[model samples]
Target: MRPTSLEGLPPTDNTEALEPQRTAPARSVVRGFMYAALGLGMMILFAGLAWSIRGGMEPPSTELETAPQTNVVSAPDPQIVSFKKGRLAYQVHCTRCHGPEGRGDGPDAMALRPPPRDFATRPWSHGETPEAIRAVIRQGIPGTAMTGWSELLSPQELDAVVDYVGTLGPLPSQNTEASDARKALLRRAGFEPVEPTIAASPLTFEGLDGRKQTLDQEQGKAILLIFWGTTCAPCMDELPSLDQVAKEFADAPLAVLPICVDEPDDELVREVARTRTKHLPLFVDRTGLARIQYDVQTLPCAVLIDPEGRQVGRLQGGKDWSSETVQTLLRTITSQATDLK
Candidate 1:
């Protein structure tokens, strides 16, 4: 018989229908929900940590930004640098023969005939201009110890050295200018008007009469100084003209001095003066002071000094010093007509 309640049910032929269905536990459901919430929280925490690290590493951002400005310093002058280079070059190559001060008194210069140029004197053997100086340095003098340096020095180096060499040259003296009228007279007389450089070298020398004489050319008195040597033939040949001029100017205010550049007691110098130079006093350099002070590179160089002790002009090589033109030159040099500005 079928029962109204399961509790009162009895055994039946189909017993599968009488079993109860299974349900999930409430504790297990609660535990699963808690685990899901924990997992979500962990994911949020990890994302926040990653963002914090990225923010710390990055640089702070600014609203406005621009490139930095810099102050630039100018470089030194190239010519100044080149000048220093040139000084070094001169010390190495030229000082051996030209002397440290360019006085032509180097130790090696003692043996060389036609001694190295004294840059202190304005007269260069070749020329005085910068271009002319460069030519001489590159091409060199044919019959002298000076050899071409084009192959040795670079173009820049050559120019630099030439500039330095100019520094060794003479400074302009008081009378640097000559009036046009005076200039014309000088040319006709074969006198190369000296671009007055240094002051007059003091005239302190020994005389042929065996006496120490310190001759000073006074202002308002004109004088001519002839630098000669007993060894030089050209200098010897000019003695007659010197004697003639000495006599010609004896009565005048001008004094013609033929200074002997030999030793104070040189027999040849004494003999030459005794036979050749009459009327003119034989003044010998006692200590070679004249050559050194006057920067006399070669013999037969005549310097004309005005009344003001200003060296007005120079005549190189031998000349007929007593000629009418020369006499006129002498007279003009002594005259007050040539007003030097």
Candidate 2:
């Protein structure tokens, strides 16, 4: 017998009892939708806030500009006894100004007054003996950019530089008369055993646009002339920083000329100009005329020429043009030019 409600008239349907269960699932779905919407709203709000903060910030004027100052360490007894060690040391410290081959015609050699000493030449003024060369490296020549490296390099490193230098030229011979005569000649020429200034010669090259450009045309403006070549590994390394510098001073009255010393065809030159450099004006010295004019003996060098057509500064090897020191130097040059006008 089926059970019937005690007080009601009709029997209730069993489905009616399941109605709350169905409604409960619906409520749960609604809550889940609400939670999703709230999460999405929070994400949007954070994104907007971040965008606003970013917009309010200023663009940085410099990038990785400052380098930490290093403390000077006294050199220990030289442990670099091998020629290989000396060669490596020379490459690290002397390659920029002295050149990789110790030719004394490093890229920056042209800008230095009296120029660097040609290791291959006879009669080294500082003496060809390893000890003499080491002394010069430790003491540095007066009135020149060659600062004493005693504080910067270890004794082993100094020995290495000396050893490397000796390999480039003949060592001091028993005959002292020739060396003495060479020294006397240098003194007579007012070099004081070392010249104080080297004049920068004018250079001419074909621009990417087929325009014939000469250093003389840039006399009225300060010139930042970069001598580089494809064969030079160091020169290739410096290109990116050089491009940054070119862009930085685009508006200034300074001519940034990056002359390639490679002998490439017009199409190749155009390709290199378009791809390698960032729209920086490119020039080619196919005949090596420009290199000869500047007396560039090394790869990857820069010359800062004043309006008077005088080379005021020079940098050799790979340089960080983005550095604060480099920027300050450029600014100072610009300011001086303005004052003169």
Candidate 3:
């Protein structure tokens, strides 16, 4: 006889024991729904964040400009003195002007007057000997853009860089009498010595005097043919200094001719040339071919020519012609021209 009333049955404990089983599935279902809601909230939050970040941003570009990559020389034999450290230092300090391959074709090469040395080919201005190179590394070229690295680099690094520069050039030979004579004309700057000095190209240009002439017309006098552009800041800075030089040497044997590489009709160039370089003869390379003929790849570059119309050497960069060294050099050139007569 089972009792029917609630809490009356002794066997009710058996049903109570099975109650958890009955509720377990429902708790699992509730948990699944809660997990789905949490996942959906996370997805919505991430999508909104992405949208905000992408707004007002530039479209990704496929035609981006690529910069030069560091091309460190390969590993060398351990027996030899390692230039690895020097190369690393060069990349840090010198590559802006000296270039990755030490070719002097660095990105800043064109902008710098006395453009960086073309270690791969051309002669150096100051000196190219290891001792000389080392000294320059330590002391720097005075009044020029080259600065000393003694403070920034250690002696070991200096020595290593010198060695590295040593490997870059077969500096113009200084052995023969002809070589010596050729170098003599370069007394003004690191004018590249021409072994068999070449004839000056008959560059035809328009002058401020409204006369059209060829470079050969100035053949009888020693020449300072300067190539400049209106855009180069250094060229503008060099104008007054060059003007003073031209006036000071007016009666001298040298004929200072500043030639503009800009278009003949460029009004800005014309105005600047007339006012800034008043003392010098004005000429504009109208054909746009003079630079190719002169091999002038940089601005404020000049070619020193003998009265015979032969190119002695070229000077690259703006300069203070009034400086003692430059004046001395100019005087020497004048004296030599007088002797040539």
Candidate 4:
């Protein structure tokens, strides 16, 4: 018999007595459910707080416009070099009129009605592209004192200087910053930006060898027009590579015209002549009109024009002309006719 808590209750089995005591587990279960609900509510509150904080945070800023890719020589870590070049080029060719650092305070600045460009402060007067800068160097601003320096500087030097000048004003798309820096280096070196004007439109040139070559007459052949000058160092570096390219495409319709833009300095010209360059046509721009026609501002600027006169590819400065990719591109371009025809 089991002992009973109630006095009148009959004695029961020990197991039956223990059954009432087991109700504690049910109470525990209820308590656990209540605690679980409280934890879930707190968790939801914390999650809402986190979301609010995230919503209050500012979004990231957008990026600026990027500059287009250019067909110009690129140097690594070109900024410092560009700055030095810009400063130097300005002092040499531009200091007389444009003043130091393009502030327009040069000795000759006092004579001009509209003072020379104060490059340090003003926005670019021209469009902000390599081609745009090239255009200004090739064609002078109509009413301004900015005269075209087509003959004054080599094409590579001119591009370098113009690239430098572009950096003075408001920054163009950052992609061009490298090019601008290279230009600065050129500027500091006392160089001017110039464009090559090739008269290849009608292609009439009385070469140094006295052979008359006309652009119109070379209709059936693909023309690899190379504009170069004697003073250009980059052009010198590119000659051997150009020789290789000429040799590789000898049997093809491709024709290499290496035209010298410098004045007839017989001794200097002879020393730098392409004598060993097989199958390359060496020509000279007697009147310097070629620079104007082709808008060639720099030396070692090469363009591959198709049979119909559409430009296929352009290589600026020194390049590995015999590289498989470049050679393949040449082979492909020469094989096809231009859409311009």
**Which one wins on lDDT?**
1
Candidate 1 has its poorest 10 consecutive residues by lDDT at 68-77
Name model 1 segments beyond 4 Å from true: 1-178, 196-198, 217-219, 337-341
Better of 2 and 4 by TM-score: 2
lDDT tens per residue, model 1, 57-167: 977655323444221222323544676678789999998899987888887998887788989876676887789989999999988889999899999999988877876
- Candidates' C-alpha lDDT: 0.73, 0.67, 0.72, 0.63
Candidate 4 regions exceeding 4 Å error are 1-200, 265-267, 274-276, 337-341
> lDDT per residue, candidate 2, 304-328, as tens digits?
6655555545656777677766676
How far residue 284's Cα lies from its native spot in candidate 4, in Å, is 0.2
TM-score of each: 0.46, 0.42, 0.46, 0.40
Consecutive 10-residue window with the lowest summed lDDT within model 3:
70-79
Between candidates 1 and 3, which one is better according to TM-score?
Answer: 1
TM-score ranking from best to worst? 1, 3, 2, 4
RMSD of each: 30.2, 19.5, 19.0, 21.6
Residue-wise lDDT of candidate 3 within 176-200, one digit each (tens)?
Answer: 7745754764664556665445546
For model 1, how many clashes?
A: 0
Candidate 4 lDDT over 1-341, as tens digits, reads 87566777855788877877898898999999999999999999999999889867955434422544222222322433443554566567777987654567889888887778776543567765778877887777888788887787777567667766654444322245643653343333222221111112434454555555766666767887888888888877777888888887778777888888774443456567646455566776655556655667767787666564444345567666776656665665566544324
Q: Rank the candidates by lDDT, best first.
A: 1, 3, 2, 4
Candidate 3: C-alpha RMSD after superposition: 19.0
Q: What ranges in model 2 sit over 4 Å off?
A: 1-199
